[model samples]
Target: MLTLHPNSNQDVVDQSLPVNFQDFIKSEFHDMKQDLTSISKDITSLRQELQDIRIAMGFINDEHNKINEKIAKMESKFKAFDALVTTVEHLRTVNEKLEADCNAKDQWARRSNIEICGIPEKKGENLLRITEEIAKKAGFDLKMTEIDFVTRVSSTNKVNKPKPIVVRLQSRYRKDDFLACLRKLKVICQDLGFAKNESRIYFNDHLTKFNKMLLQRAKVLAKERTYKYVWVRNCTIMVRQNDTSPVIHIANVDDLKKIK
Candidate 1:
């Protein structure tokens, strides 16, 4: 039995105890089963989401690998192209050097040779006899035995365009003496009863095709740049700015800048 005061603040309450132990255990077990069911559903959903994430990661990794492969191939191709370009450049440089050396050797072969131009050609004309005649006329006192080789050079058979005579002297002394006699050609023409300017004979060192082009180019540059003289000496193209200017030996076309 209980007694309550009139001003006491109280609420309804259940003061009961478990009277059936087996029934309570069954109820508790049922609640736990429900909770476990919900947890199982959540765990299944989590596994699905993890699978999706794994698939996405695999796709990204595959794409990354493909991109890397492409980049590697491009790098390989670039290296090959670079190597090819380097080889071509090297071959071109070597070829140019060989050509320059060949031209130099060819010029050296013609070092002791001289050429006579403006001399008219005739049938059965003896070149050695004519050389002696010209030398004697120029007061050179030259002999026929001083000549090593003599020939007329003509690329075409046109008789009006007479070819020059090429002469290889037996000695450098004769070569110098031959050139000196050529300088006095005006005297030779006087002795031969020809006009001063009518001799029409010119003497020069025999030059290779390359050196000839070099001389031609140097002459053009000298004229265009107003140089005083452009001449060939010992198969070399020479340029001078004035009478007393230092002689510039033109070894190649690049040397044209000296006159320019």
Candidate 2:
């Protein structure tokens, strides 16, 4: 037999090794199995992320289209509402002016009127005579003709508390005299045989219906603001927080806001 001579080269040494290609392939199979498992997991995660992105992108596109459509619809309304808003604003302004003018007329009508409280109501009392008597007691001369109207405030039902009397005199001078004489309310109550508790009477200028409501609300606000007293003078409601505090005249609802 002829012996093969080995070439002294790197390739020759590699081929002369005891490890064969089949052994190498078998050793790599276990390592390749682990690598394939990791690769498969990576591919599954990538697919899932891609699917999530596709769904999110579709939702975002749909919402964006919806918003664009809504904006287009509202854009049309902007122009259409301009004229309507102007008309409404004009009507609101006119209404305020008319209301103010009407209130002025109402206040003027009540210029010579006076409101009296704590006057006990009698079943068949002569209200006119009682008013004249009250005027006389106040150190004033009042005739039956000088009085324009006299009546007690009406109520739906009879109440334990008497309804106040509203007396309308013919002249503003007579009304002033009536009010001035009311300052000596104590002496009048004593002469009239009224009890001490019943002596706490109130006399004030008759207020218009609107101002009456304003005064009621202002009184409540005054109490909340720690005012010592709320009283009316010359038909205007005034509030004092304490004895030394400056008087605050509440002419309307707007005046109440300054209290806070």
In order, how many clashes per candidate? 0, 0
Error of 2 at 229 (Å): 4.6
Q: lDDT (CA) for every model shown?
A: 0.77, 0.77
Q: What ranges in model 2 sit over 4 Å off?
A: 1-67, 78-94, 155-158, 187-200, 242-246
Per-residue lDDT tens digits for candidate 2, residues 131-195, read 77777777677788988999998633367767888898888987878787876666434455555
Extract clashing residue pairs from model 1: none
Worst 10 residues of 2 by lDDT: 8-17
After superposition on all CA atoms, how large is the RMSD of candidate 2? 8.1
Task: Please write out the lDDT profile of model 1 over residues 110-183, one tens digit for every residue.
Answer: 77778887766668888888778788777788777878899987633366767878888888767877786676
Model 2 TM-score, all chains together: 0.62
- How much is 27 displaced in model 2, in angstroms? 25
